[model samples]
Target: MLRRIVTFVIAVLILGALAWALWPRPLAVETVAIGKRDITVTVEEEGKARIREVYTVSSPIAGQTLRIDRHAGDAVAKGEAVVSIRPVAPGLLDARLRRAAEAAAASARAGVDLAAADVKQAEAQLTYLRTELSRAERLASQGTISESALDKARLAVDTGAANLDSTKASLSVRERELERAEAALIETAVSDSTCCTDLKSPVSGRILRVLAESEQVVQAGTPLLTIGNPADIEVAADILSHDVTEIRPGSAAVIGNWGGPPLAARVRRIEPSAITKTSALGIEEQRVPVILELASPPPQGLGDGFRVVVSITVWQGHDVLAVPVAALFRQGDAWSVYRNVNGVAKRQDVTLGRRNNDDAEVLSGLTEGDSVVLHPSDDIQDGTSIASTSGAQ
Candidate 1:
């Protein structure tokens, strides 16, 4: 009877050990507690800095532009000469052309001489008119001549003076023609002459580019260089057309990842039109250009065409109830999270508001200090035993 009782005790002990070994254990997971903090919703995109206004310097007239002495990035003052050009000499004329030019010059000289003679004649006529007017006044006062006769004399003098003035104008025109004829006859000789037309800078700024650096003949309106103020820099970000609706003028922004600390900026304008471009992934996209003005001077090394990352603040709230986005997942039609209650996982339905890349604003269901499982696994179910890696049971 004693041996049978000892066997029953050993069998009961083995059964209890088996049951303990097979019992379900708590699954380890990462969790975060609901907290109150400032949540900012931002649209992140890459962009570039550019001058607010780029002025292109162009040749004002056709001439031989001299070699440019200044290079790109050189500072220039307003009204300072940036380029120098000399008028090209006229092409060589043949014998017949030379004779024609000489004749034209002679004719012009004769016209000038005639003009001088006409001026003298006009002066003499004016003087005679003055004398005649004086005589007429005296006659009218003494009643020695009819009033109409005196008036007729005055009119004759005025007509003579007008004729003389007309002749003088014709002579001046002829003199200009003579000069043109003489210039045509003279052959232009190319030489290193100091006389040149200097092109001045329109604004005080740095040279952005040197379009023409070598000596060459340029026509009027040919672009020579570009200039812009480095301090007046702005950012241009290309955003998808769909995302443009959320942005507005005067929106706050942060410019970063440009080799220095982030800079504060604001949206100045949104282009009214959309442009089509092929993305690097070989996809066609419609993008709209948004202009951003920096709130302060850009950090050193930031200049025109410098690449940067921009985060535009679309929405923000202070001291709002929020949670890590990883904790939230779709449960049926509403958003839900695996809330840790004591040592078990409980499925809690949550209403979400504005969300950024990392955090989401919690509207209902979850309260401050509540722990929720981050990236809950498929195997985790309501009422499942769980433990948080962050010490939350």
Candidate 2:
């Protein structure tokens, strides 16, 4: 009876093992068929939306910042006043200049008066000298006047001419002084009145930053504000130097997350210098900065310094054999895919060319109708069986 029982147990165990080994199994899987499609190779980088023109309003002369007309994000017009500053004191240099001008004017008036008096005295002397000379000439012609008397008359005429010349010189000096004083007064008055000047905007744009406030004292060359236009913008993105080889001017780009829908962009320029940047992964990366010009008008609410996500298209091809990136596995330096054939997984070595984030270009070893496993596991080996729920096992 014991022998029979043991034999029965052994038989049952063997049958159960055989049944488990031959049982049909199901696989949790996602798969896609290979096909000819478009493929694009791209490099993605984070950037910021910045205006094409940024004008920094700086103090033209040293003074106190009296008032600010606009704040950050305020709209400004060309030739509009943005800030007004007043000097600590009416320009001392200008004040001294005014006083000097007043003194010069007073002196000029005094000289004019003196010149007029001299002119009067010269006219009186000339008249007396002419009368005396005439009398002496008449007397000499009558032979009653001496030769000495005639000589004296000639001397008097010459002296009168010298006196007139001296007076004319004095008058000329006075006139020049008056002209100089008038010019000086005008200049001084203008300077004193302009001790407070209203600063104006140099361009039409929105205010980006305001660095001054009312009643604040500012030094020479201090920056007061910044303004820029958002409608015209440029996106500067840094690309890894390794990936920059395929990127050139005129490449296409897509910008996102900049307070608007994705905007189309085009590469306008490539920086000549490369910069070293540390990535978030703690790796030192050599990056080249590329400048992109927006191809369309920016949407509303977009402003300067807005962060954006950029995808630069380095290369693209149409009607190319493409495969999902998950379907590929790296074997040493080459690529391979696990294709489903007759309910069995067949490992086929493949040659891949350009690859993007989601797909890769299949250069060889893939047919248009072949279905490949996405993310095949190690449990799936050559000739391993698979059961597709909708189709076959």
Candidate 3:
């Protein structure tokens, strides 16, 4: 009888201990106090710094770049000569080509001069013909010449008149030839000027690139140097296509790593075209280029093509009521949070709005000064008992 009573009591104690072990208990959580603060949605991007206006200096004529005054990073002002070009020893057909070009040019000039002379000669002939015709008519009228003789005089007058007309026509043709010759002369002179021609900067800026080395032969239109104003700098950053819809002109930005401190900026323009850029994940992303104008000019040391870090502000709110994003929970399209009231957890459905960085805008259901659970778990249910510690409320 004694053993049976002892076994029964022991079995009851074990059953009670097992039940206690399996029972639910209060969950520990992190909490955040709701308040108002400024939040901004930023898109981080890496871009290369570039001058506002870059002018590529090219050879105006085919020649050798014989002189260069300044190299890259050299400061230059307007009308400053940066490079000089001199004609190289003429090409394979240099002599013959030169002679032909010179001949063509001379012929054109002569043609022009001849046209002017012909015009003068034609005017004189016309005047003389008019005088002779008048004399012939007067003689016929006075009967000093017979009818056939008068007729002969009239024919001579007609021949003179025809000659005058032919001279005038020749003058017109020669005038056109003169224009052609002048063009030919210019072309030949440009190709064979042994004297050096200076290439000057059109604007006050710094040299960004040097395409020509000393004593290098170059053809017309070959770029020699690039110069631009470094004071007026702009950042061109590419943003993902999906994120582009949220960006617009006049958006705020923070520019950094242009060899100096962070600078404020604003979006000036957004390129309408989209380009494909391969991401590290091997996904092809459609990106749109955006131009951000720096609010403050960089220091003098900054040069063109320098790398920069840009953060474009896509959305912003100031002095608005917000809550920590960790405190919010999403269910379908709705968001909710666990509000700690008198050491008990209560579920409050919240209407959430624009969020940025670490904070989110609370539209309703939660008021300022309310404490909400941060990163609440599924086990924290409605009307649940809770304990408040320094770390967890």
Q: What CA RMSD would candidate 1 show?
A: 6.8
TM-score-sorted candidate list, best first: 1, 3, 2
Residue-level error in angstroms, candidate 2, position 306: 0.8
The residue pairs in collision within model 3 are none
lDDT of 1 by residue, 1-393 (tens): 899999999999999999899988899888877799898999888999999999999998888999998999999999999999987765789899888888988988888888889888888888898799889989999999999989888898889889888988888888888889888777867677546999999999999999999999998999999999999999999998988899999999999998999999999999999999899999999999999999998676899999999899989989999888888899899999998899899999999999997889989999999999998999899999997777322
lDDT of 3: 0.81
Ranking by lDDT: 1, 2, 3
Off by over 4 Å in 2: 1-18, 21-28, 90-194, 389-393
Per-candidate TM-scores read: 0.71, 0.68, 0.70
- What is the Å distance of residue 136 in model 1 from its true position? 35
Tell me the tens digit of each residue's lDDT in model 2 across 172-196. 8888878877666663223435657
RMSD of each: 6.8, 8.9, 6.1
Could you tell which candidate, 2 or 3, scores higher by lDDT? 2
Cα lDDT of model 1 overall? 0.90
Candidate 3 residues 236-265, lDDT tens each? 888888888988899889888777778898
